[model samples]
Target: MAGRESLPLRRLKLFQPLNRLTDDQLILLASRAERRTHSPGQKVVERGVRDGMDYFLVAGTVELKAGDGRTSKIEAGGEKALTAVARLQPRMYDVVAVASCDFLVVEQDILNQMLRDAPLIQADLDSMVDETSGGTDEHRLLMEFYAELRSNQVSLPSVPDVAWKVRRTADRENSTAEEVASAITADPSIAAKLVRACNSPLYRGFNDVRNVREAVIRLGTRTTRQLVTVFAMREVFSTKQPFLQKSIDALWKHSREVAALSWVLADRATRIDPDEALLAGLLHDIGAVPVLVHAEHYARLFADANLLDHALGELKSDVGAAILEAWSFPATFVEVARHAEDWQYECRQDLPQLVDVVQVAQLHAMIAAQQNADLPQFEDVPAYRRLGGLELNASRSLQMLTEARARVDEVHRLLAIH
Candidate 1:
């Protein structure tokens, strides 16, 4: 039997969703996960079969074939192999070993259950902290908070009604810009902001637009939907507790910067819609909101910044994914929320994805803020390479950002909450 110590936990952390797990949860996962091997030409997974398992390539190579004859290769130790081979259930592809291959096989149910129980596990661990040693009782407080979060007692923020209405109006078959404009008008503040944004350098035209209806017509329904959501996102970052306001403000600022960078990168380097990329960047760190909300109940945790940061770092990705999922966001935005921080994450697609744009944008934001000391080299990041035309050296990357400073500030000013 494979024990926790026998599993390659470090390498496993490179995988998505798994990268979001807490250290204790990873230990539990390692114990249940098993190692397997396949000889060259062996079938690793069959198309259209429900195997109830996820296969992570650990060594050698495998080829994934679709019914239509489309194929792709994943090589061990490469960024592409960091995620499961054909992750969808009732497998979308038939995976065959191209060389002798080593794999880490995790039962899907076990992994799901572990993820579901993560908050409870953290709560239990915090409950064990000794309180009599004059230490802060944040552990006990957090344990209670985590228990509430696990039980859904802690309310996750709802998608603002105006944003939801705009999405619904835009997504309806045959919906017009006029109908979407009506949705925006329900929240006059967002309506005004949308019109104002349309005039900003990010979307400026030869002539200025004066109203929500004209703004919607100029921006198109899809861009209007996204901008409405972006404009409304500020309300989600609020905190009633004065002590937590600074952290909330900082998070909002960081998200705006990343959103701005994502917009510029997508507009310049990829075919992805700049507005969609902007939305992805804005919501990437939204998971931190619930964590901060919970922490407000335990004011002492604020005194120990590391403890709060650790909690936010460990829990935000999963929480953000859940929040977006509940809001009916497309899979791409949900993916950005879940894996944008997975610096080594590589998409299966040949082209850059919204997540890739947001990831590179985040790195740029960090670099600009002088927080790149611990980040991966720009040239080595898979997302950076996928971006193609951009120069990847630190000086060159900084130069690109420098060139875009005016546009970035325009976006930031457009989206920043007053």
Candidate 2:
């Protein structure tokens, strides 16, 4: 069985690039890769299906026929042995095994995780993805989407009115805590949740806070602004479209967890404001809202989750950055949204930025969700190392998050009031 599992790695020369991986990372990655045998004259993949899996022929010959009738054969261990699919999603070609074949298949997300952990592999894959995307229709679509957004041809989401008022009021040089409280209290539902949040284990002070003013005072103006903004942002996530409801719900759940974890990490590790991290985490996936909205109008995208996810991966950051910019969010918050998924991204100085806090928090959230089976260890993720200062075992990290459950729960409850 072990030999069977390793066959794909051995036959395709993937073993060499994979040498950059540490033993633990490699084990995690290899475990997730699937090895298969294909009989002669069998189709490996069909054209026009949206798939993000990378496939490499390990043994025997494979025929590739493009949609335009161009054809080529990739022999086992040929010069192109190391290549996977040239274009990831909405496959442009039909691939078939020319003889009994061994094939290695890796999921796109897993490959991304490997690249994130192995910088050398990341560098190579970066070049590969860019080169492959050249002249592709998907590339053209992404560019056109970006151009439309930049030209305001597509309407971007607006910040909730309450979030806007709270943000603008808090931005004033002379803004007082009481004024911040007034802005929050205008929305009675949000005001009640803010009070409840102030009393939660995360922010509870000398006594139970009963009123919005007192809650704002206890949490302070900056945190109040962040809390208000996050509370208000929840309204924008709702959709009347049935197909996107599940995805939107998942997005919010993920966001809330990231926001809670970001607050904890920022409070513990860095000099940056915990509230800033909180807001950053809450809005990290805000770009998906627009994509789902567009998908609603163009119903075809609803039929394929892979295609939708790929589209989100391609456009979310730019769209998110644009939305935040439209809302006049702080430069740090806007930057956090723009680069939420960029784990290798570094800040100007040694101190971790809000972006780092959000990234680390997002990683922790993923770990908790058990969606990180193939991801790098906490120690290997660049954001965790930069923000955490030391590697933490899974147990230690889980303990920290567990201990903060009350606070995290409180944040979730507060946000869910809408």
Which stretches of model 2 miss by more than 4 angstroms?
Answer: 1-151, 390-396
Q: If scored against the real structure, what TM-score would every candidate get?
A: 0.69, 0.62
- For candidate 1, lDDT tens digit of each residue in 1-418? 1223335568768876676477888887888888888999999999999878888788899988867555667798764565666765667688999999888888877776565555424443344333322344544465455444433345688888899889878888899878888989989899889988898877889999999999999999988989999988999998888877889999998999999999888877788998899999999999899888887777664556755775676678767876775565776887898788888888888878998899999998998799888899877888888785544455755677789889888888888644
| Best lDDT among the predictions, by candidate number | 1
lDDT for position 261 in model 1: 94
Candidate 1 lDDT at 103 equals 84
| Residue pairs clashing, model 1 | none
lDDT of the candidates, in the order given: 0.78, 0.69
